[model samples]
Target chain A: MLTSNRRLVVYGIAGALAIGSGAAFAQGAVAAQYRWLTFAVFAAIICVTMYVTYLAAKRVKSASDFYTAGGGVSGLQNGWAIAGDYLSAASFLGIAGLISQYGYDGFMYSVGWLVAYITVLLVIAEPCRNIGKYTLPDILAYRNNPKAMRIVGAISVVTVSTFYLTAQMVGGGVLVKTLIGIDYEISVMAVGVLMLAYVLFGGMVATTWVQIIKAVLLVIASLVLVMLVWTPYGFSLPAFLADVVGDTKVQAKVAGLLGDAAKNMTPQELGQRFLEPGLYFKAPIDQISLGMALVFGTAGLPHILMRFFTVPTAQQARKSVVWAMAIIGGFYVLTLFLGFGAAKEVGPGVIASIDAGGNMAGPLLAQHLGGGPDSFLGNFMLAFVSAVAFATIVAVVAGLVLASASAIAHDLYVGVYHGGDIVPPQQQVRAARIATVIVGAVSISIGIAAKGQNVAHLVALAFAVAASANFPCVLLTMYWRRCNTGGIVLGMVVGTVAAVGLTLVSPNLTYPKAVRAASQKVLDGEAAKRSAIEAALASGDAAAIEKATVDQKALDKAVTKAKDDMKKVEGKEVSIMGLEEPLFKLKNPGIISIPLGFLAVLLGALLFRDKRSEELWPEVYARQNTGILASKATSH
Target chain B: MATAPKIDWNAVIADPRFQALHRRKQGFLTGLMIFSVVFYFLLPIGAAYFQDLFKTKVWGVVNFGILFALLQFVVAWGVAIYYSRVANRDFDRMAREIAADYEKGG
Candidate 1:
């Protein structure tokens, strides 16, 4: 099916990945025990999900089924799916980890995510369901030049989804390595292959079910953790909170972790300070920027938006948003308890020692709550939570892949390249499958290559892009009367460029790094000297070998020092633009970029006047509001 | 799918019921959106500016800041529930009638 050149490219990529991961595999370390328990849980999960996939595969007959599950998903089911898709490993692991380390400051980071859903329920959800079909671009292409709108929309979807997918993939791999004993490369490969199976075979139907299952599991697990955490305090909320802030043991734990940073503060001061804000977000503006991104960006996330299309009516869509808000809001509330519980029970020092970013806080707490690491209950709980986290990654990534696949296949390949013609449904489904494979392969390769790198910022970057690029166009096209094809295109281009451009120059990227050229020169020269000494020491001449051995020890010490010096200077020596710091101090660009997006949409519409767009405005508005002439749910 | 009835766009927009629906819905949505945005931003702003006030303990380990933050969840849910009820009661009925009238006219 593939051309020789394409096959060669695929083979070349595969070969590079093999060789790259092979090198890292040699040094791979596994942190937790009871590998068999993790494997057993993982096997059970895969079997159940794959069986659901098999059932879904039989029902997927046309492009509509592949894209929107034939528009048959119930409101409650779709809401669960949305919750599952939106709450990735980041929400479950990352937020808990942050809260466990930073206390109240970490809890502040989570509040915005739940409130953002109100924006979706009020402004975006129903209109999107009424106007869209199969993909997000359908809303734009409804009243604009189909080719231009679909193409641009497809690009935006791919860009946001790719950034998000990479983060999930890398997180999944690292967590598997820590939770189970699997090598990172093998875990990444396994996750990628499993995701491909779901998207390529079962399409949206299976993705939705996987998400529902994962959401239920994640929620139940969090609830259990929360209950177990508070039970020690006699299930009293006030008592728990009091203990969190007043317990001498907790204060000692915090003081020990703070070490030199504790200053002259006593246990009481540290305990009281732990319940205040300003620990994680030292800069007020940074918190505002992050808030802006979470609030606005969630409404624009392509995968989350795509879920709206799976249900039939705008009413159902509206109901789903309410359901999602409750479920997601409850889950986020649970994180507060989980984080503080982990802080008190597991201790920040132990948490940081495991993963440094506190990613292991939730699972580690589970182990502690089940009776310490040496107990069987502890091992079982850890394995169960870790497996749930793994499932969370798979469900989220599958949703992303499906969204981008629809963007590529339904929006660009069929909508644009086919000149907006009605392609055969089977052909469209086939195209979507092909797109799934391409998207999966590309994200997997990037994920493997980005191993062990700090990817927490990628999630924020995705949200910023979605907020800046996609949200503006969707809002303007639906609501603005004079919004033309030119306006939509220009808005997308300008918004994307502005958001990405600002990020490039923001502190997110412009932080210091050691001069690569100088560092590499010293390292390469030292490596050569060490090799020379190693060669001489390998010979049988005792005196020469003894002298070479001394030289080898000196070379080794020099290399170690050189590496340490490089690490120390990484964020101290220089920045990309040869400046001490970036001009843009805000880490997340949403506060500025979101407004710039709206301005671009306004300017583009005013500048590029199109009579046809204005003429069609009434019909588009009526359909958006009243849902007349909207696509019906496809009957099986 | 049945062929869609041809309708006058300007006339529809000019219709009293349609205008009322649009006016009421927009007024509600715009006001709520503004209030929510401002209310949402108050978190970071209040936390930044009112540090001493926010740090005042209310109960055992509870402080003004944590209570305020937690109240956001309640506020968000309140807004959603209230809006959905209003939309279902008034907006949906008005929109439906407008659609039925248009169908008859066309």
Candidate 2:
């Protein structure tokens, strides 16, 4: 034990250093911003969290604590942890950016996210807690069917968690690089190292506290920012919101972002416009698909489901959800205020100049509220909010790493490879800790690879997998007696295939290339025409001048023609991959894939009905219906 | 894990008391799930199919769309809190009773 522990420590330190050194080689170039205050705040946060981890490490003596914090977490604590876990940097920054840029359409994600908890609360929470042990597939394998189910379960959990982990890492890199003069790769490594440390030593207990602390910070920051935004108008929320919409500068930015529909409106009219839909989500199908993805996608998120195991008893699982829903629901409402606050407080011009993606709205708003961007207080607030974002990312990434690692170590390694009874507890825990380092390192590398990528789309695709592939299997296992190995496998395959297939050919992948090339061609032609005119002017000939001016008209005509050509194919079904048109147009695949996922389960059950599935029903039912299996539930 | 619950769950499942418990729990859970599906989908569906109606302003700056969107969070919270209360009072109690009844060979 002593020797292995020493080896583990050596590995942990080596992994941490590897992650730290990794940030040195990333492809990020935006190192234009730096603030010592942000660094100080980040250092302070690291100290506090390291202390929390030390506390958690001392207590975690077994696999149970490593995976589920010994199932001793309180409902309220779990609630906050879930909120922290659920509200990724996307929720903190992206949703606010969406609302700031797109008006009411941005809040759609928040609403969908909040309501998703109802599905978890009502359908998944109690059952998942009751039927499973360390991982979700624990429930699927509880009835003597571990081999295929565990493997599939492990794969889905790892896939979803890795995607989530990658997104957090990318966001971390972008955020840190933007806030301070660090390389994006280095920032990603820093996040990875810290995330690894948390999972490696502290396990679920430390991860839970990290999340809870971050959640508190996030909510408090949002609340403070909202108050600062509203206080300027004497605390009349209506007046402040109207001012946010009514600001002439805001109108211009809105017009620029969304076109003329948002331009030249009176305060009342602009307010109404902002409140109405269609700022970002232009199509009916797009909005519906996004909504479907957010609602169903959340249910299958491995990190979120993994949280339920941290609390003992199915009842606490149920209670934690209610607590989570309440906290999450309130936090989302506050995010609306944060969105509006950032829009009004920071202003979009500053937001865009800092980051074209508008990701700087929250931090900029913090700066603006604390006096000005350069003020001591401004830097302080900015640093505080930035640290909250860092904590948020770290907390979420830690959970993802822990979960996927457990899926590997608990479900696949011990439960599947070693069969049910072969692997010892100590070995399992050791494997899980090692798995954390491996998963964290892998995600950090992927994070470095995806350095400058738009993580929003990646997150959406992850959601697609979660909803269609992961959730369907989990739902089937919990509710359907007829759902056998074949049914589960079919559901996962169809769901994953449909989602990935649709996304591959979807407008998301196709639109950028065609649009960029077409628009860039027009700009290049216009630039050439202007330079030729400038060349003609240098001759100082009256005839040349007149000829050049006349040629300008032709150039204008050419530009018009170019624009017309681009418009004709703007969103048309044009082949993305050498075909006449892309096979899929919808940006989100959830609406199609989720139904396909369920259909596959039905078809598989009917077509390949397992003879022993009926025989296993008694045991499955027993596990789900009572607390009697609680001991067995904890065993594996 | 040690000494599996000796109660005959097959018999318990067949018992009317267990059946009632299962029926009640399933009914409530399924009912909430369906309601959530419809309730949550309405905003997206309404935004898609009934844009004009959703755009209609109910207040000075607030439109039906924003109101409906915000309403979802409220309704979701209401459903969660309401379900929590109901489950604590009803479903959990029913489950405990059924378990006890089975153990006692009722």
Interface RMSD of 1: 1.5
Q: What TM-score, over all chains together, does every model reach?
A: 0.88, 0.88
Model 2 TM-score is 0.88
Give the Å shift of residue A411 in candidate 1: 1.1
- Give the per-residue lDDT of model 1 (tens digit) for A236-273: 76688877777554575456446578889976788877
**What's candidate 2's DockQ score?**
0.63
Stretches of candidate 1 off by over 4 Å are: A1-33, A247-264, A513-580, A631-636, B1-9, B103-105
- Model 1's CAPRI class is medium
Per-residue lDDT of candidate 1, residues B21-106 (tens digit): 88999999999988888898888888888889778888776888889888988898898899889998998888778777676656
